[model samples]
Target: MNGTATHRTVIIVGSGPTGLLLAGDLATAGVPVTLLEKRSHDISNLSRAFGVHARTLEQLDARGLADQLLATGDTITGLRAFDRLTLDLTTLESRFPFMLITPQYEVERLLERRAREAGVDFAYESEVVGLRQDADGVELEVRGADGTVAVRRAAYVVGADGHHSAVRREIGLDFPGVSVIKSLFLADVRLAERPEDVLTVNGAGDCFAMIASFGDGWYRVMGWDRHHEVADDVPIDLDEVKDVARRALGSDYGMHDARWLSRFHSDERQAPRYRVGRVFLAGDAAHIHSPAGGQGMNTGLQDAANLSWKLAAAVQGWAPDGLLDTYETERHPVGKAVLRSSGGLVRLARAQSPALRAVRALVSAVGNTVGPARRKALGQISGIGYRYPALRGAHRLTGTRVPDVALAGGRLHEALRGGRFVLITPDPQAYEDPGTRKDRLTVECWASGRRTTVLVRPDGYVAWAADAPDATAIEEAVAAAVG
Candidate 1:
């Protein structure tokens, strides 16, 4: 490795959400991150994943970007069941009371801006052609816009590239899963009878239709028909996709010209492990599933957030090398759960027989029942149900994500703002500890009379909590977390 041209921390790909989020987090932590992308410029128009869940909003809030996101996107109060059944997610009790329905293009733009503002170095139109890793670090071979190749080195590397990740392939990580089903006709079209307010779903026969009004007259409609087939040579036509929508929704409803159209086949896959040697994977590179719960993109962004902090800690020499291993241990199960939930949703939508439809409706009804049952179902879809397994010697509440609680001064989430670890103590005296640094961990006093403690990460996830305030307990939790 030579002198001037090499980046201290180089990310081998893109303006995409996963890459950008990681870059932004690292940049904000005072880490110099070089983000290389093959795209010449930012993507202006793309109709990919659009639903941003509540948990993601909390993460964005920590970075001071939640208001910006909500301003641009519609606050989806709750997903409507069938056509008329609204779930009223505004009552769900989250920092973000509702899901943010913004297109993927906007998500990318927002993250890119945040990354730039945080000082992430950009190398557009540059692609990582090859990478060589040894005991020390990784040497990446890149080809720039002018077709000139150069070697870039970093202490570590991340494979945030998409489903067909070149980084994963180059690193030879195993992604085991299958293309479970192949049926698609996805489009963004203007409908004659544009459904006002909420999203809709009509599962009748092999005719599966899901439509949501992302404002404007435009609606994202996805449907499937078993008997109908696309010609081998023709890419899925917008007109064909719209015809399926018109047929499934109702023949009388005329489907007009579409703004965008594409075909998709669901794949249920996950990397065997998120990390191998010094390299790691995130986003679509680690897992890919149906977009039913809008979990695919959001999950990837969360992966970036989880890994960035651990990586920054490890690279800065403040944490144990084993801190990085927790990434896979924590996220792999979540990925498995996603595969199960999304795959089930897809199967329910694609179930053609009368018996299956009846069974699905009954299950849905049962799941939506009041109290705990309703909360669980809503939690699953909203990405709030996730909790990592507790570590050894952890308090009963430790490792369990802290419940979103209210405080007299502000909300528990407010203390977690600015992408830092927050230690919530019932006693304000914990702040007097001399060894504890304010910059590394912020101590906030909870006005709630309960003498409990909570530690939250930059992503707004509760990493550790205790039933009572104890300096030893808090210090141990901090050591476990950052170490």
Candidate 2:
């Protein structure tokens, strides 16, 4: 170890939503966090992502951030696919049941603010070029904009940089996947006529287009003409963007005053492993996928949420054996599933062959008519369907996310604002004194008629639950979960 190297408890690379949220969470938990970013601190107005799902809203709500975000975005209670299947989120079980249509920069702005408020050390314009990890800590070689280089050390390091991550490369992790969609064009422009739908998306045989207002005067248009497989750097003509929109949606809503235009491709890739020794990867550094369902940024935020508490536990010296490993075990499956579903959506949208078109029609019909199919599809897309694997002999509720149920003190999510485990039981006496484990657990009586004891994790998942419980079981479960 270098004697003069700057050291922190945790160093997070990339100041995007994932790294910002992770740094905020760690800092909020009283863990010292340093955030490194290659870009300056200036916020950009252009964005590729526009939709935030319900589960992500729930996560933001847990941190008392949902209201601010909701204020900045418009809500769409229903989403249509294939111009036939309508996934209704209005009846979904969440405080924010609809998808929020806002610019990706808005989300990043909120996270960055939270991170700053939490006192995260920001090292902007500093790019991580190399990484080395030993049994105790990880060291990073960072190059500043002025060509100055420095070596920094941290007990743990996380890579939340995008798909072309230097940290992942330095660790020799393989991002094994292929490009799923190519030559997609994106444009942000002023719209003279606003669409009735909050989000309008449709795909024809060889063309696709999606339009969503930023709740500002500007609208984001994303589309692609399958016939044009141009390079990303090629300048995109406004007429081409409008032509694709007209082909897919029948009109461009008088799109004009182009603010931004670009061409890019989407890839479906996942790192072989999320962690290597003391270094870890999250967000785009760990996984990337098509932008079909707007899952990219939301999945990254959830990844940060899943990892932050565990990393905090590890830093605080209370994480049980294998707790840190569970981050990969739980989140890797979710990443794979996102890639599958998002890729499926892209394929469905691009279906042109007679057989594939027929299959797509059948799926749309079934999804529209079948209650379970619609519910499942909406749940998965909105991130409510995800569940971690339960441990042996664990409760049925274990691994499932805890809904924002009404509680005696406040909403279930409100109770989690402090970032502590909440134990709700019909019989509170079953658990030992909360005063003893106040730092790790909070005991509360059930709000209403529920004869079960449920232990909710910091990230809003049910860690353990039982219809009938005793002090011994509660103690053991707590010890097993948080040590």
Candidate 3:
């Protein structure tokens, strides 16, 4: 079949953070996974995504990698937006209550390490040239660094590839959206003077810019000039960055001596479907949005987290009915919400006219004065407040994100490292029955006097919960959830 296809349980296209995280998760869960990357094994030092949100950190924490990443990155407890509004990340209920500012490469390094150690078959410099799927499985035509093309088969295929995904094209999925910002340029340069704030952002009528430290001697300066808009192909130099910063940020902290500079555009796009038969898409392949709130990479990583355990369950043959379809049902709306929120931020940034300014004022006023709205904004940006849809008559806590509460053994995330649904019960004695034990489920007892018994998915969302200590109900729900 298809010229002797080499089979794998899953073939993940792309080696970016999404692919790496998904590949590592599957491998950690003992699924045979092959990660096909067009790039070589050598790591790149350059990074476009500098800020990792709190929710992503939590996901990594569950994977046992967050502390290492946090140790190396700078933490900002608050986010400055519109030069007036600030989101207090410290108020978040999660353990990581701040944004970690580090390059995307750092994340890749950690994930790649975990994946390699977990036995992921990495095919570096192997690009997906063609793909096909049938009722049984999916097939792929991968081209290696050499001229040779090889046919591969997999139970499922995931496109964690970037925006211009060959897998998406192969599957005939359209990434439908437009560019939100044009002629955006950024550079890592040394500032001759320090800014008033650790993270400086401002915008005049014609330009907008932001400055943040990399903790190294260099700084990242991102700027956009409305009056001098040009195609992304135009070459950007240190002067363009400096000029925009001076106009908007009022000095760019006397920025100079750029180490890296580039011009590009940002888009707000999401695939109409994240899953097609045996093939799936996650991360940038499924959705992308403006970096206005630094949500692009964070959203992609979260997509991978939502999809990984489901894929594992499916591969292991214990997945519940329609479990695979839930990936799109849960993640697609979150992708749309990210696009809307990030697009709104971009539009608000460029708002100059009386009407636009009024809208901006209203948003800022609401963010400052309204506690609920402010919390929502923080939740959206930090990726914490999102919940999947639950069926009718489900528990009130069903589909909501479960906080990392203290268990008798350890933290909730620590218990999730095995990539299994964790049932937190105050009545551990009741769950001691052999019927409650499942290979794909972990049972933990509460450290504190908690009345609610909650079943948390591997990705940290509550699958089922009950206020009453009903052992029979929990056993039935666990059987339905994991088996």
Top candidate by TM-score:
2
From the highest lDDT down, the ranking of the candidates is: 2, 3, 1
Each candidate's root-mean-square deviation in Å?
Answer: 2.8, 1.8, 2.1
Compose the digit string of candidate 1's lDDT tens values, residues 251-324: 41456787777776778999998887778888898999987778888888888888888877766667665778
Q: Give the poorly placed runs of model 2, Cα more than 4 Å off.
A: 1-8, 434-436
Segments of candidate 1 deviating more than 4 angstroms: 1-12, 80-88, 231-233, 251-257, 353-362, 370-373, 407-409, 433-436
- What's each prediction's clash count? 0, 0, 0
Give the Å shift of residue 287 in candidate 1.
0.6
- lDDT by residue (26-138, candidate 3, tens digit) is 98998888899998887775678889998999999999999999876688899877857889888999899989988788899999999999988888889899999998799
In angstroms, give how far residue 323 of model 2 lies from its true place. 0.5
Tens-digit lDDT track of model 2 for 1-483: 223233338999998889989999999998888899999988788878889999999999999999999999899988888868788889798888899999989998999899889988899899998888887888899999899899889889999999899999999999999988878989999887889888988887689999998888889999989999888999888999999999999998999899899999999999989998888899999999999878999999999999999998998888888888989999999999999988998888788899988989999999988888888888889999899999798778899998898887879888998888988978756777646567777778778988888889999999888887778887887777766
TM-score of 2: 0.97
lDDT, model 3, position 387? 91
Provide the lDDT at 415 for model 3: 96
